[model samples]
Target: MSTDPASTDPASTDLVSTDPASTEPAPADRARGFEAKPGAIGSPPQHYGNPLHEQRLLAEGTAVVDLSDRAVLTVTGPDRLSWIDSLTSQAVAKLQPGESAETLLLDPAGRLEYAVRLLDDGVSTWLLLEATEGAALHTWLDRMRFMLRVEVADRSAEFATIGTLGSPSLAPAAPNGIALHWRDPWSAVVTGGHQYSTAQRHPSADWTYSELLIDRAALPEAAALPAAGTLALEALRIAAWRPRRATEVDERTIPHELDWLRSAVHLSKGCYRGQETVAKVHNLGHPPRRLVLLHLDGSEGVLPVHGDIVLAGDKEVGSITSAALHYELGPIALAVVKRSVDPALDLVVTAGDPAIQIAAAQEVIVPPDAGAEANVPRLPRLGAVRR
Candidate 1:
């Protein structure tokens, strides 16, 4: 699909600029950096509770997160169902009211452009994607419309997306036994006592007490709202072992490499651009690497940044992609380690403090027909061989 670079907002650009104020300061400025500004990279205001830590707290308690960084696209038309199903990996045509699915929009080369959560509100389907790739996803969908009887528009400015986390007692109950209500990633149950509407536009109109919206000029005020930043969110994801599009994926990464096939890919779906490669990798080949979670020995020093190597003595087994300190779990990280490594083996993060420690990541099992093979990489022997 053809993308117009001019369509993006200036503030949303991912490229680090040369502006003195924007550039990361030197090592001498490390201590002062946190004190410098509230919104600096790796440093958000304390009110937000460190984006890395907030995600964990949100899971344990009630928290409202500003997901304005996600881009929204609205598709409406008589043929919208067919149009979307032909492009994505999920069965979009069959999505019932109030249901959502995570799907991928792939490039011609089978690489991912953006992974999105699609919410179907009966009338129109909303595609929520990473804020950084919003414009690109919009343009790609628009260009693919060609002669299809569907209309796709970027509605990012018109609607705001916020994430709410809490217990069944804290969130409003869902109607009609539809226990799963899509606010974003987490599901909410609308209680029988309250007459709730699943309409996105009327989110505030019906859910009086438990609703929030995060926009450019507007921030919702609620008792459940936690003051957290990106770092806290990263930490929580690490604890849950949830992967993000940026830290866990790139052009070289495939869906199975990060175990995305579990949620994002549908094996039974009809042919799509990247279906062949996905099938080949699943049935005939193993993912070159695998994603794993690491518990760092924080007492050693600071955690390493993304792409830092993981070592088994002199051998590089993997690289750390995401890391954060959890209030409960301590310094933890997510890494794409070599499948060859034994999950029980101890390893070391080669960045930050030399004394940092990492244990084998816990693995979540995938379904048999999903195409993952049993012939995974084995970890090297650390001690004396018996035979």
Candidate 2:
């Protein structure tokens, strides 16, 4: 059967027991089917009761999400800024204290390894990620520390995260002190980045949510906001054309394919693990794939699951990564399609044992022609004569 239309847990995630090394404790009573999360750790319920209403609360900036299942780490010491700057896609050496920026960890091939939500509060730079990535990310950063003064520690137990739309001040500070908030930079192009999505108004241009680093002691209070779940947040994100770490990224994923450079990449940034690939794809070659929003048909009451093969007739061109029933847009999804797929072709989502396939119209996010050519010279052929 299709996921419970009434069910808010669209991801249908499973619970991941807390590891002994994890600072997190066992999940609370309200947490059950929420096991299907970005990091696989059990989180609070998809919604206290109503999902649509809860989605409203989250979108209107009146709710908060329990991000404890996600992880938080801190980078401390003097070399933090410069060291990080030398390794990521963003310019962080001059990051102002308390300001928020995002960065991506890519392989030398420019394929995304991880993306971080960052905030530097003078004392320490906080890195927030899905629970699944915490250990590996921490270990990777620690190894890269080398002789630097930076220190990496898992802060999940000491600090939890709460996500809300709009300004970081949507809620009051925790009893201990004001929580550090990392504002999302998706609304516009960052200083040294460029946008590949040609839409006059990018969907994420309306994104204003931030993840708050709060005292874990405030879990109850933070999760208290109308009891919305990841489903609610995911719907809004999908509608906004936002690309997430888990669903959108694959082993071959790069920032350009999803138009992520609008905020997460800096074209002029110093060298990092994947700088060459980033520059190469942007300047010399086009991304192998492009991102698109699929306005799925929900009349059958079936929503395509992630990994559902997308076809333009019989040939598989892509697959759906994220799908949701938005409050305003109804059922919609984000898919990574072949860069050469005809823009005018009708798309279909193929999934389920019965093989329920639904037709989808393409709302192109990244066009096939997207690439970098910073003053690329159009050299004439040696034997060609001017007419």
Candidate 3:
């Protein structure tokens, strides 16, 4: 359905004027947020702007994101904190009122199930995740609650979560400091608290990265806020190198492989499902792959697609998971490279119309005693263990 700007704001000059029937579809449906230009692959509808461009802007300036596509769940009761802490990767029990953390739900094998942002709002806790998995995650969490006093309810339909990308000064104010910065790329600011199924349209309202909870009755008012489609959101995500559940991770992907352990996994927290795998991988074995940032030499051609092979010399070292023509960084991407691949070596993505050149990611090193030395076996030379 076409969005009505007048229904949202009588004073918005930024609204694009068009006749619903006469508006020919652009190469990409700039309205819904898809990158489906004539020859491009179909993508989710757009939200605010190009999510990738928004992410780049967020890094250099500020941008708003519509996270309505993200699903929300509410857990209430005195035991909410303790109950949730027993399930996810973060130390949810230690979070004070108004605090938030980024956490993960893992499968039995320690592979990722859902990555979420947990917000403690004094009386209840909110879990925000990608909308695609909201229902399943809610059911999973509900089933896991055996004797805990907490009540789990899927609030996805009730709340519309928005995301803002930029520094704190540009973000909306929260009485309890900027809604807790759980990871570098994410923050959670409660919009409607426990208010269920509300909607409202606010002309002056900026729905960028802020989650706005409105009752269904308030949808007209909520639509008043600048509406964004999904394409813009995707662009923003790629720019930040932020990985989502379905696009970047799958059933066999571990938290460490996605750099999630740095932000989502609490190294000192008590046990939870898959904790043993986390501990074993972190303490004993080297993760098979590592997520890295790629600066594609745009001079070649368009960006590559997911699963595109990354080559170093003639050896395959990694595969690209996400790529975009970043407004600021040219063609940039995120890739999962073999942990054994030398960081100094130059790589190339073999996917785009013309191969895109890739540079090694900036390596973040660990202190000497962080854990046992990584156990990636060295490649044997012609006849010796030496290169």
Candidate 4:
């Protein structure tokens, strides 16, 4: 996905959408006094008039955010687990029913192609992903199943994703006999995964975000719950240092750059596409770029947008991949910058036409030497070696 700045118009394809074939608005879109988000990559409401209050309610697990624009795909057959395990970054060959796992699809070079949130209910494995990725991912998976028993199908029209900070009162849809709820794994390192952030206490330690899948027809019931909006969700997401594929990924992105190995990549997993590069970067070298959090100076009362240039003094060091105005944190952003950029340097983001610079305070998420986890011993200089 482009990760470009988006518009607030509800009908704009640049943000969010339901089924393209359905001309009618989604049930959630008809909520009382819904205000669509202009800059969201998917078409979800920005808020219900009181964004900050919504954020507080959401953080307290008293509110639900509509994520109907996210796509749902299903893979089934006896060969499903092993088949997908061999093709993606996660180790899912033995995934238990109702367990959640994240994975990535990469090119041979290990650059991100797609990011998927997976849940298996025994009979079928459900893949939840960005709406823009639905068709392409489904097509790719189908084509790759040349002789495998696995079958792939797009089920977005039948189900919708609803976001919450933690367990909500709303029941998940069980079209397949098992309730579908995807708990995010960002709060801690999963087994076989690695963490690159040096923070003594990770922000995601408090991130209880999860997605509940529901039948499309049940959206009105979901909307009737104490509801927040995508804007509220985005603010909390940024504050948690979560890496979302739709806004955080780009053409050159690799797992190491964003410290995605913490949840999405299995370092010791069996052979899979991009494993070589994943291994090489983690065990031998540092990623060229590192993800960071920027606490923007909100004195100007302006918030930056996606693709805004990040500057370290006069030199361009990075670009803001995601930005939001948090209820507690004020204006903040997630940016990917050159690993060499001094984390101590004050940064600036240039946003809007006839651009104005917004001062940013840097907070490192991925350190400069994030990889080389193997601790390979350095060889002594030939002449300095003791005889």
TM-score of 3: 0.68
| Runs of candidate 4 exceeding 4 Å displacement | 1-42, 380-387
User: Candidate 4: worst 10 consecutive residues by lDDT?
Assistant: 1-10
Tens-digit lDDT string for candidate 1 (1-387)? 111212222222121111111122222321222221212213222223133345545655555544444566778877887788878665567877677677776666666667778766666777776656677777778888888777888765654445554432323223233332354332222211111122243212222111222332333232234434445455555655566786777667767666666556776678877877777777666667777666655434456677778887679887877776655655666787776776666777776444444433333222122244435676668895766
> How far is 309's C-alpha from truth in model 3 (Å)?
2.2
lDDT accuracy of residue 223 in candidate 3: 38
Q: What C-alpha root-mean-square deviation, in Å, does candidate 2 show against the real structure?
A: 5.8
On residues 1-387, what C-alpha lDDT tens digit does candidate 3 reach at each position? 111212222222232221111123322433332211221213233334344344455444344334444566888888888888888787778678766577788877898888888777677777777656778888887888888888888865555554444333323323234342323323222221111111242111222343433333333343343444444445455554456675678557887676566557777678898988888877676577776667655433455667788888778887877665544444556777777777556676676445544443433222112333346576677767543
lDDT, candidate 3, residue 352? 43
Q: Is candidate 1 or candidate 4 better by lDDT?
A: 4
Count clashing residue pairs per candidate. Answer: 27, 3, 48, 7
CA lDDT scores, all candidates in order: 0.54, 0.76, 0.55, 0.83
Better of 1 and 2 by lDDT: 2
User: Against the hidden reference, what TM-scores do the models get?
Assistant: 0.69, 0.87, 0.68, 0.89
Q: Which residue runs does candidate 3 get wrong by more than 4 Å? A: 1-62, 166-241, 352-387
Clashes, model 1: 27
Q: Write the per-residue lDDT of candidate 2 for residues 43-96, one digit (tens) a residue.
A: 544445555666788888877766667788889899998988898999999888
lDDT of 1 at 196: 16
Model 1: lDDT of residue 144: 88
